[model samples]
Target: MMSSSPESRIASLGLTLPSGATPLANYVPYRKSGHLVFVSGQLPKEVKEDGSAFFHQGKLGESCTVEEGQAAAKACGLNMIAQVDKLKRPAEVISRR
Candidate 1:
């Protein structure tokens, strides 16, 4: 049996992985040491087909509701996965810390 690739899985879900965001500062997004990779915190930003971005940009418990915060977290997860998919061995990812 042939398992679907990560990009295929994402496409099957009717989703597209947006381009990774540029670093806000001088730090790189991820660092790999041996088999372990540490991905930095990512924000909730989705790029549209026209290249505009849709993002939740407010502090939780302040201007954002619980549901909105949850959505933001999900977006962050997607972004992290997108970053991980670029790895040399994406299928080898064991667990996300």
Candidate 2:
């Protein structure tokens, strides 16, 4: 049997790239220097119908529950994937090792 690709896996999980993957503040989503690409400041944010952005708030272990934190983390992961996709690189560049 053929193993599912990363896009298929993400689709099976019901996760999609956020509408806007741009960073909220002034900094760019990623910077590539030589063979290394550095990513920073990807948050759990979604764009609303009115073009406004909603950010997931609350610190983990403080105001956020475990499930909420997990969901936020998932969103952040999606956002990071979106950023990597924008750079024309495959997500498999990140690995378990």
What local distance difference test score does each model get? 0.81, 0.74
Tens digits of per-residue lDDT for model 2, 27-65: 988887766667787787766679787778898999988
The residue ranges of model 2 lying beyond 4 angstroms of the native Cα positions read 48-52, 91-97
Model 1 agreement with the true structure over 1-97: per-residue lDDT tens digits: 8899788988999877767768889888888987788888577877767978899878899999999999788788789888887788654655456
Residue 88 shift from truth in candidate 1, angstroms: 0.6
Q: Which window of 10 residues has the lowest lDDT sum in candidate 2?
A: 88-97
Pick the TM-score winner.
1
Model 1, global lDDT: 0.81
Error of 2 at 15 (Å): 1.1
Shift in Å, residue 86, candidate 2: 1.6
RMSD of each: 2.8, 3.2
